[model samples]
Target: MSSLREKLKTLEELQQIDLDSNEVRAELETLPAKRAEIDQRVAEARRAYDEEKSRVEGNERERRQLESLLAMERDKVKKWEGRLGEIRTPREYAALSREIDIAKKTNDGQSEQIKALVASAGELQKTLEGKADALAEREEANEAELKGLEERQAAAQQRLAELDARRAEAVKRVDPGLLSKYENIKRRRAGVAVAQVIGMTCDGCHRHIPPQLAITLQRANSIETCPNCHRIIYAAEAVNPPAPPPA
Candidate 1:
């Protein structure tokens, strides 16, 4: 039969497995939030791009409307000039001439405005193109990062499964009462039931143990709980002594 020291060592191994499982579980719980953060960034980038596109489209619609209005004004000026020679009186001719002049000025102003808009359209198109490229780049980068996160999550899940299986098997090696005591302490001590005794200190809580208890723990004849933290403490010297120096 294995000594008590061997049993306690096995329990510590199980504790290590459980601790690893805890870390993986923590990562699994937060993986979705990490993914959500990436999704949010993508959504924001898309929204910004859409807003810029809408503004450009609005400018185009306005330009078209102005062009249509200018066409009508030019047609009016042409019709009035054609009637200038057919006027019945000087006053009528003067009125028609004034109307034609006003319409020509309006047409000239509309043409100038349209030319400016067309020039600026090139710049706006360039801006739009730049934004699109940036959005696409962001999407690619975000997708790659998201993929990496997914792979990590999958690996952690697989590791947790393996650790859990190890824990289940390891539990079988301990005495039933000891296992029950360990479970009880694990629940109350934040998932750490066993702590190693290094020197005179409890590794779990970093508190000093009594000199007598520390000496007793080193003997490996029995298992004891830390007086201050109440975690099961064992001496590593009993199970994992230092290697002898080569002659």
Candidate 2:
């Protein structure tokens, strides 16, 4: 009974260490994917900013083109008006007037186009400014998040190293046969190789343990396994109990 109790104690300790190690390892595996998600968000923000900038630049270019065309039309109207006084015949005068009218109308159309382009450029500029601000905020947030994740990963890695040493020490304390059984059970049972019997209940499978089996576990007479889950079972009260009842 004493040997069985000692073995159970050692196995329990080994199980706890393995559980902790598994949790840390699982977290470590997810860290890279988490970092990648942050990188993707930052990249998307930068792309949006670039696209907004290009749109504003395009509007400005269109406005400039419209202004140049308007200037040329205005110049033509001015030259035709100046030639009006030099025309000697009525036909010549009429021709000059017609040319001036056409030039004026072209100039007016170009002016309207330039005004619309300027307004569009103004609106695009505002949108670009908003995008720039949002991008800056996103970048700052990503940097902070990434820094925090990196720190957490480093700490987890250090903890894993410590757990590895603890596990190695624990492995030395258990009997080789018992350790082999534990390893096999753990492989099949989601890393849980030991189960505690509490009031006829198997903690591992949450099944009601047979009364006879529970009694055997309570005595801690020999190594026992849960019939339902096939995991080593130990009595919870045998491990630790509350203070004795008063007289």
Candidate 3:
């Protein structure tokens, strides 16, 4: 009786260690998703910065073209003005004056456009600088956050290694056939191969155990399995014995 009791006790301890190991494994599983989420934010920030840079460059190109066109118009108006003194007839002078007037008007329009472009360039550059700052800040903060997550991953890995080592020791204490049975049951029952009987109910499957089986489990002379869940079942009072009625 004592030997069987000790074996069940060892199995229970092993189950607890396995459960802890499973918890650590689950934690490890989420690390990649966390990393992916961080990467996504960094990507988004980079894209925003790039878009702003593109806009600023495009605006600069537009400004340069407008200035070049404005300069050409000014040169045409100056050449037309130099012809003012050489006009020998009223008809030629009038036509040349009309050409000069039209050229000056074109120049005025181009100048306004250049002014608007220059004003927008300053604003665009400010937006570009703002985007750069945002990207930099996000990268810095996210890098730190990622580093912290890496540290947590390492710690969890170390913890799982310790738990696995303890589990190996626990496995050595259980009977081989019983341990094999437990493993088979665990594979089919979501990694739970043992359960306590709570009020004649199998805590594993939440199903009722037979009256006689419940009684047999309470005696705990040998290992027992729940018919419904197929899990190794024990009555709590049988193995731990309720502290011997408060001493």
Candidate 4:
């Protein structure tokens, strides 16, 4: 059992703790930071995908142009070959042969270009496909995690509301001076200000109380402070633990 003053003190501290433990605020505080991080990652992944797509598109366009040029060169070479079989004079034959050679050279250049373009398109398409697949997977993972976090946030908010209601009821019964003292101590002691005294032990610090002091503590109506931890002490059986159950 705690003294009236000590009980009120503990109640006030518990209330303060509940006030500070606003789950909604905590969740809100982290939301922007989380969103910023996720947004950056998503943007980066998307940019990479877009760049890959553009590369593939550009390669395809170049490949198509190269193919068209190759076809035109092949047709010119065929026409030149036919013209060569009908030539009679040396000058005419020489001029016709030169024209045919030019056509052959053009066809060779166009064919090489087409082969290079085709290879580039193949590589670009493969790389683009891989990036797109990775982006899709990453987006799905983010969405799933976001959903889970949101659920956790909602549950935490509901739990906090319940705690706040209890805290409000508890605070109404506490004395102002006791409440003030509890808050002051709690600020320095990680939310703990008053602890139960169990026999000769200070529960706050787990240190044994001097024999004389422990006797005085059990008899005193005034709030007693633990010498070791400076916490207000109360003689509560729960804190002092009774002897173990009989064997």
In terms of lDDT, the best-performing candidate is: 3
Pairs of colliding residues, candidate 3: none
Q: What are the TM-scores, per candidate, against the unseen true structure?
A: 0.90, 0.87, 0.90, 0.67
lDDT of candidate 3 over 1-247, digit per residue (tens)? 4889888888888888888889989999999999999889989999999998998899889889988888888888898899899899999999999999988888888888888988988998998899899899989989998999999999999999998999899899898999999899889989889899988899999999899998898788988999987899998888888554654
Worst 10 residues of 3 by lDDT: 238-247
For all candidates, what are the clash counts? 0, 0, 0, 1
Per-residue CA lDDT of model 2 for 45-89, tens digit only, reads: 899999999998888888888788788778778888888999899
- Which ten residues in a row are the worst by lDDT in model 4? 4-13
lDDT of 4 by residue, 1-247 (tens): 4565446355535744554675456776797678678767877888999999998888788878878877887887788788877988889989988988887887788788878878888888889999999889879877877787778778777777777777777766677787677768777776677776776888788999888778766554566678888877767643343688999
Give lDDT tens digits, candidate 1, residues 1-247.
2479779988889899989999999999998999999888888888878877887887798789999999888888888888887889999999888888888888899899989888878888888887888789889989998999989988998998899889889988889999999999999999999999899989999999999998898788887999998999998887677888998
Better of 2 and 3 by TM-score: 3
Runs in model 1 with CA error above 4 Å? 243-247
Q: Candidate 3 at residue 197, lDDT?
A: 94
